[model samples]
Target: MKSKTPFIIILLVLAVAIGGAWYLKKAATSQGHGAISNRTPASNTTPPPATAGVNGAEPPHTLGPTSAKVHLEEFGDFECPPCGLLHPILQQMQTEFSDRLQITFREFPLVPTHQHAMAAASAAEAAALQGKFWEMHDLLYEHQKDWHEVFDVRPIFEGYAKQIGLDVERYKRDVNSDPVADRIIQDGKRGHYLGVKGTPTVFLNGREVPFESLPADKLRVLINSELSGSK
Candidate 1:
């Protein structure tokens, strides 16, 4: 009977071990399930407010005639690829509808990713101070690849200023000054007020338009409609 008692004890130990292993496996599975339950897909919600002002209150800054019946406002970043693609379109529009259309250029430099965009914006503002905004604007877009590849913007931009006959010393100082930086910030804030969620957001007559999908012919139609309706 003592020998049988030892055998029973051995069996009992084996049973406990099996039970512990089973419990641990079950517990591990439960934890894995809990972890999976805790995870969730990100939500697509509106971003937080960053500034104050309404779309209409935003000031107009463009090369086109201020009194033109149709006003087109563009909030774009210098480094934005789409903005580069749209540059020629804007130029064509300006040439095609010189008298009736006014296009305003506003700074929306997304500096976090585009390292040189802010500096480019500053350079543009500096040129603007010297009444060469349009000249610099055209040159920047025309030579975006050169500036982006070289990683040296100041020299190239200064060259542009010199080409446009701007006061080179004043241009250099303005580009590095606080006022130019402030102007860029102010434009960004105004864009925020106008619900500008991304670069290349455009407004026509104070109304936001889906310009990415808007073909030139369709845009011309819309412009004509707005012009005729206003009259």
Candidate 2:
């Protein structure tokens, strides 16, 4: 026999290398493809009541009424693909539920991971100063693919501001203002306090909802559940 010992050793080494590769791949996959992976204890299970009302330094972008039975608070990163996907669904929900659903958007830009996220938040906040936040918000999501990867996004954002009837000159200044920066920081702090670890983390009726339940159909069911129970 040609020394079975050597063959056995080679097989063992190969097995270890294969196992290592598999583990690394699985780790990467768990980080999520679009949204940042959820690291909080809130995912897939109901958590404690979320902090109620506007907790940021500035008034958050809100749709519908405060008296609505179901309040949906979304902590989102503009450059996050999953957040972009959730945008339209939430808009539709707002239309369907009308005054019954209150939607509040909070900025939670993931820097480094998403290079343009902070800039996008700045654009929205700047637009808010012009009383056109919702318009800029919609444009950001609608044209996310256009600007997220550009070398510089200021021009694109300025274009959006102008399109929304803002004074582009003021928008340019406000985008870099202390107040704009402060608002983003404040929202991020609130997210951290709430144990949020990813983009598109949503709270429905002060309870964190699972990522799996974020789709239009599933979310509709959740909203309905909240509405019925509030009665």
Candidate 3:
């Protein structure tokens, strides 16, 4: 009676505001948590290593030498938040240790839990064919948030391939090729054999490292210990 129009309009505005806030919060949570799983399905494709070297997984993407004092084998998923967090720290460790450290990255994409995990791994593997795996790996982790929830990630991945100077057409083909898939599958088999059940699972000299020791300070101490023991 006394002009209920203003009251209804206010209610509508409040509902819209609330809905907007909810959406923003949901997006942030999804982006922050992303896809991190303790157990991932192993790939059924078990082809021979595309290239033989290192730990037997298609020459396996590695930094430093196989003869390095501290060998760190990491099983990681590209879409995983913890793996993303570990990326920079590992980079720092690589610089700090120089040749004393060898870092081997194995694919452990947690499908279903991470819708884009397989795709991301494929992108990295494709880049590997061009000898740009590390570049693509760094880019994917650095900009994880950018394409985390995008409707289509192929274009974004293409942009990354371009940024890393990869042959775009070849990259596209490799992304869907058996060789790339074989590499990932081989890594998965290794991970499974090693009893890995999570992303960022690291093994130092064939011994699994605790999650707490993954940080720089702790990992440095562990590396130093290993170095001393080897001497």
Candidate 4:
């Protein structure tokens, strides 16, 4: 999957997704479709607000209190393979820290690289309209490969919506509506502004952490320390 991506797609995603070419290209280009500049990033110590933000994105799909000491923010593309790998881990974290941790998700669709990214984002947003965003999110990621490269995905999205108990008519209408499209675009733009360059870009307490560096157990330990004011 990584090798199949064209050079341009790698360049575009590099602005925010994890890729080798992205770091090299970032210093050279400042103007393009995925250019990110003057990013503030985030501090590791403090939790960012649930409202407006300067260091990073404050996506609306929060699962805990605005006042929670631990904030885990993920800027992910629905069809990105690495993001799919992180999905189950995130679910486990969400369950384990349901009371003390707040999770915020924002879309960062790699439209140039992933053909169905925008459509998948739209589908999730449509589910969101009916308070079923997380359901659709899980469905899409769980079955990512089934529709990853497929051009026509509306029917698949609609089927998932039905399985989740959403009104199929409304889901279909919302999926094609202006609001859903705009929301996905807005999410991606915000993610780009935060120096997001790939799927599964994560922020812990507003600071971006290396997912590879901190495995789930270590991350859980970090969270516990934060909650205990040990850090």
Highest TM-score: give the candidate number. Answer: 2
Across 1-231, the per-residue lDDT of candidate 4 in tens digits comes to 577568878778776666666765654443222221222223333443323444332247777787777887788888899899888888888899887888888888887899998889889888999998899999999999999977799888888999999999988889889888777777777676666777787766645555542467766765675566523
TM values, all candidates: 0.72, 0.79, 0.76, 0.73
> What's the count of clashing pairs in each model shown?
0, 0, 1, 6
CA lDDT scores, all candidates in order:
0.72, 0.84, 0.81, 0.73
Q: Which ten residues in a row have the lowest lDDT in candidate 3?
A: 33-42
Question: Which residue runs of candidate 3 sit more than 4 Å off their true CA positions?
Answer: 1-56
Lowest lDDT sum, 10 consecutive residues, model 2, at 33-42
Cα lDDT of model 3 by residue, 121-199, tens digit = 9999999999999999999999999988987999999999999999999999999999988888889887776666789
Clashes of 4: 6
Tell me the lDDT of candidate 1.
0.72
**Candidate 3: C-alpha RMSD after superposition:** 12.8
Give the winner by TM-score: 2 or 3: 2
**Model 2 ranges with Cα > 4 A deviation:** 1-47, 52-54
| Model 1 lDDT per residue over 103-128, tens place | 98999988787888998898888988
Clashing pairs in 2: none
